[model samples]
Target chain A: MRIQSLCAALAILALAGCAADPAPTEQFRLTEQALEQAKAVGATDDVPELKLAEQKFTRAQGSMADQSFKNARMRAEQAELDARLAEARVLTQKSQEQLTALDARIIRLRKQLGEVQ
Target chain B: MSVFKKLGGGLLVLGCAGLFGCASQGSESALQQANSSFQSVKDDSNVLRNAPRDVIRAGESLARADRLSNYWGSGADVRHYAYLSQRYSEIAREHSNEAMNQERLAKLELERQRLQLALREAKLLSVQQQGKWLEEQIVSLATTETDRGLVMTLGDVLFDTGEADLKSSANRTVLKLVQFLQLNPKRVVRIEGYTDSTGARQDNLQLSRARAQAVADVLIDLGIDEKRIQVEGYGDEYPVEANASERGRAKNRRVEIVFSDEKGRLGAAR
Candidate 1:
């Protein structure tokens, strides 16, 4: 009975470890995807926050390499946020540039109309 | 002891059910948020066309999230797919905004070009009509449209014999000319006076000059700008007919008005 109880305890311990210590693979994937999203929007050209996001992603990779999954997950999550911010920034910048060009063209057209009149 | 075992089993079943319920709730919230984000931009044609792949990806991810939340009972996968759905939706929204802006800008550019063309055509039409009206008025006056310019005669009926003073009856003819000059302010005119060969040369010259000056003064009074009127006297120099006949002499005693070109400059052609 003592030996059987010991085996059961060991099995429970193994199950607990398996359930509690899963690697943050999904989080890492999410971070990678977010970074790709930022890149797809040309964040590298105008988004200053993209550099910070890259740094955080590199730190996440370092933590993952060291098997510090909790730390890696935290860094990856933060990197994802930074990447999302970079994407939004790039989108806003591009919109503003297009709007400014449109405004200039409108002004030029208005001046042409004035001359015609 | 059997009752206690039954109770323990029931509690375990209940606990598992509770855990599953919590996971389901979390998945539901994520799926809901993702679906709402997708719906927000679904109607945008720009999003549909320019970012078609992104929009489709978002829809597919949302569907997967819904399936995971409803059946798979894996909150992790549900949340992952839901997040992807929302992210792709964002990308679609961004591209859609850009496409819509481009379309609007193109429309504005076209509108401006159209308006400019319309204004130019209107101006051209107005100029053509103005030129036509001026030509018609000159024709109605029985004036000669010569290469030198328009020439209209104010006969000796406008002045008494051997006198430079204008009679009141002359005002009717002069008023017609004033109306014409007022309508075409850009055109300048020269007034030349002449007389029969019966009078002494110096007297005829002086009388002719006085008569031309009188007409010019009256034109100025009638609002024909003085700067546009030039007066000269020619005592029997250019005759329209022979001096020997009474009718020819009557015609020679005249004041001829010459209208200049658009620049108000009378050329030396006449």
Candidate 2:
């Protein structure tokens, strides 16, 4: 009966994890994949963030795969949030990209104009 | 044309919709007050057009959140993210509009100066005794020359090399024009940006816009009415000379400042 109670407790914990709302599994996968890609881009300063996201997600996926569904679900939720923070860094990088590109264009144009003039 | 308008309309609509979605939530969310740092930052941006220095700093801080939009989109704590995103938009619009207003006022001053100069030019050049003949001559000469209508000239230094900005001397250049317009209070200023043939068309368009905006910002900073300024970008489409020459390209990378006689005040917050 004591063992049964422990099992019941674990099951309830698992349900709580799974029931956490407002995001989808697909979104989780995207974050995971994006984190992986970010890792491959070695120069990216957000690698630490991606790594954190990756670690959380991997743990979450592991628990779910092992049928510790509640634990897995909780980890998954945490992982999703981590991935989003990392994604924000990615967006900031993208915004800076425009400024960089603009600078480059000006250089090239001025060079070309100098050559012609 | 309608299709282009529809697409642009769609983006503006989406932006506004996105803005309001968070606004309604922010109204109800204790999160606004819960995060004092972010909340102070969010609240501080609201002020007279020349927002306090601290307020400007707060607005700049929200722009730093551009990186967090991905997580911001997720369903987890969405209300919080939405509120932050809306705040970012508000800050950008607020500062940009304020800057824009300053540009218009400066341009008006420039026009006033130009009028006085034109009068002097007319007095010297006009054979007639009346100032009317001088005005006629000034008007005639201005219209005949397409490139001379207050547009930045070829070889005119708009910016320092390797920069996406106006030169430091741009302040004086803009101020001189502002002083010109201050002498004549009845003109509207039009700011147009253009680029030479050396860059990709799309980028050139943007470059032109930045150049124009740089001038306009200076004008607004000089106390030009924001409402009286009209900013547009023409990119490389109307190059005055062949891009095949350096001089021509130099001329192309320019901004035009035109004065309008319309008496309507600009920017009553439409």
lDDT values of the candidates? 0.77, 0.54
| Per-residue C-alpha lDDT of model 2 across residues B156-244, encoded as one tens digit per residue | 48586424477776665566566555644566677778788776889888877777777788788889877767787787887768889
lDDT of 2 at B207: 77
Give lDDT: candidate 1, residue B228.
92
Q: Could you give the CAPRI-style class of model 2?
A: incorrect
Docking class of 1: incorrect
> For each candidate, what's the DockQ?
0.09, 0.04
- Candidate 1: regions farther than 4 A off: A1-117, B1-22, B26-98, B104-108, B111-115, B145-149, B154-191, B195-231, B239-254, B259-270
TM-score per model over all chains: 0.44, 0.30
iRMSD per prediction, in order: 6.3, 19.9
Specify the poorest-scoring 10-residue window by lDDT in model 2 chain B. B66-75
TM-score of chain B of 1: 0.52
